[model samples]
Target: MARFLGRRLLVAIPVLFGVVVLVFLILRLIPGDPAQIVLMGTNASPERVAQVRHQMGLDQSWFSQFVIYVGGLLRGDLGYSYISHGTVAAQIGSRLPSTIDLAAAALAVALIVGVPTGIIGGFWPGSIGDKLATGFSVLGLAVPYFWLAQLLILLFAVDLRWLPALGVGGPTALILPALSLGLGFAAIITRILRSALIDVYQQPYIIVARSKGLSNWHVLTRHALRNATSSVTTIIGLQIGNLLAGAVATEVIFGRPGIGNYLVSQIQLKDIPSIQGIVLFIALCYIVINILVDVSHGMLDPRVRKAWAS
Candidate 1:
């Protein structure tokens, strides 16, 4: 396991380096100068604009700026925001918790709902309950998150008066946004787990367990669930990435103070450092999640473990 983890980390280095280059270039490729955008409403002179550019290190060549950024990143300094005049690290640090909390909550909802529905569907592949679960999954996937969010808000917040429309008030405040963000993930997980579990149920060991007088629930839960988790784990890691990306829209719609909202606001203000820092941080998270997934796959599947051992 140690060697496998070490190898994964080693392989991730180049990917992360590529991400650093790609994110920096992509942000610069977008039209509009950060300095100009930052000074948009100001009556600043050319010198003032020049000063802002200089302070932002924008006057430097792209390669030079890249070098500076890479150096700063190595030193754990994500640079200062051109617009906010605050350290980029500080800005992201403030917003990171909100995004993490929201993502975690959404993932929790997905697991809570997805796993059981999947188990039942696998247990009874063509029954009314299975059909209903499949139908719900289809609905969850087909609907746009923003549209779904508004519908949920309308139903629960406006009409029913069951929950607040926005803000981080408490657990109630979490329902609307979490549902909007998590439903699709829940659907995906359910479908995948249903299929995987069905395959596992048809295996020889499952038959043996049943022949040995094991009840349906025990056979499914103890033996089948353990084997089915590999696929589910993969889906979970992927959904985490989706959740991060989707949270941007969900945060805005629900008026939450998260990394996604912070990124959106900074982009409009052309806070390049903040944008770059946050994006890089997100990319890092994605890479780390995938790595963890790879590690988990190895742990759960002996074939993968043996391959890694080789």
Candidate 2:
């Protein structure tokens, strides 16, 4: 287990390094001058722009800047943002909790809604439950997030007056965003889990268990659920990566003050330091979630645990 974890960590190092380099270079390549943005007008004198560029280390060669950036990263210095006038670490810290909370709530809603629907759909294939599940899953996939968010607002917030339209602090603020994010994942989870459950229900062991006088529900819960969970766990793990990637769009539409909104602001302002920091932080989040999922799988399945032991 230790060796496997070590290997994952080792691989993550190069992966994160490459992400940093790529984002840094790409942001630099974008046709905009940070110094000029600071100058606030195109007619700013060249000498004044050069001084701002030098101060921000934009005057350095790409290689030199890259090396310095890497060194700063190794020392836990994520550099200052040219636009925000604040350290990247501070900026990320301020907004991290909102995004984390939003993602967690959304994922929770997905699992709560998806898991049972999938189990019922798989266990009772061709029945009314299966048809309903299929319909909901199809709608989930077909509906766009922004559209859903807007429709939810119009229905619940505007006409019905049950929830707030914008901003997030209370339960009302979270519901729309969470549902918007969860619906997509719920559809995906339902599909994967239904397939896994179907396969598990057909296994010889499940048939034997049923023949041995166990009720269908008992057999499904005790045997099929455990077997199906392994696949569900993998999907849930991958979904964490998706959340980090998709948070931006969801947050923007919802007007939630999260890392996604911060990222959007940074990108618009071309704040390279903040952009790089956020990207690196996101990569770390993905790696950590994947590792946790692997560890969880090891704990849940003895075969996996034994494989790690060997």
Candidate 3:
């Protein structure tokens, strides 16, 4: 397990390096000068702009900038925001918790709702439960996050007055946003887990367990579900990215002060440093989450464990 983890970490290093390089180059390619934007647009005197650019190290060549950016990264610095004139790391740190809270809540909602619905559908593939689950999956996939968020706000916040429509505060504020962000992913989980479980139920081992006089419930709970979880785990892991993406729209719609909204605001201001930092942070999250998923996948399946060990 330790060796497997080390290998996964090693693989992530290059992936993260590529992300860093790509973000740096891509941000530089964006039109309009960050210095000009910082000086309140092109109205600023060229001398003033030059001074700002020099102060920002924008006067340096791209390769030099990249080297400096990377060196700062090595020291855990994300640079300063051109517009806000604050350290990018501090800004992200403040907003990241809210984003993480939203994402975690959404994931919880997804698992709580999706897993059981899938189990029910899988346990009786041809039954009404399966049909209902399928219908739900279709509806979930069909509904867009913005539309759902608005609908939820209208029903729960506007009409019923049971929840807050926008912004984060306590648990009540989280409910609508989490539901809007999570439900679609829940649909995905339901489909994947249902299909996996159905396949597992038809496997020879399942048949053998049943033939040994084991009850349906016993075979399902003790054997079939465990076997099916490997696939479900993979889907769940992959869905983390989707959940974060959804949070972007959801946070905007609901006025939640998460990194997603922060990114949007920075983009509008053409804050290149903040944008680069946020993008790198998000990419790092993806890499780290995937590593965790890979490790968990190995632990869940002996075949995978053996492969990794070898």
lDDT computed for candidate 2: 0.84
Q: Give the per-residue lDDT of model 3 (tens digit) for 193-242.
A: 89999999889998899899999889988898887888889988888988
TM-score per prediction, in order, is 0.94, 0.92, 0.96
Q: Encode model 1's per-residue lDDT on 66-170: one tens digit a residue.
A: 898799899988778756778988988888888888898888888898888887788899999899889878888899888999999999999999999888978
RMSD of 1: 1.6
Superior by lDDT: candidate 1 or candidate 2 = 1
Deviating ranges (above 4 Å) for candidate 2: 32-34, 37-48
Residue 309's lDDT within candidate 3 is 75
lDDT sort, best first: 3, 1, 2
Q: Candidate 2 — which pairs collide?
A: none
* CA-lDDT, candidates in order: 0.87, 0.84, 0.88
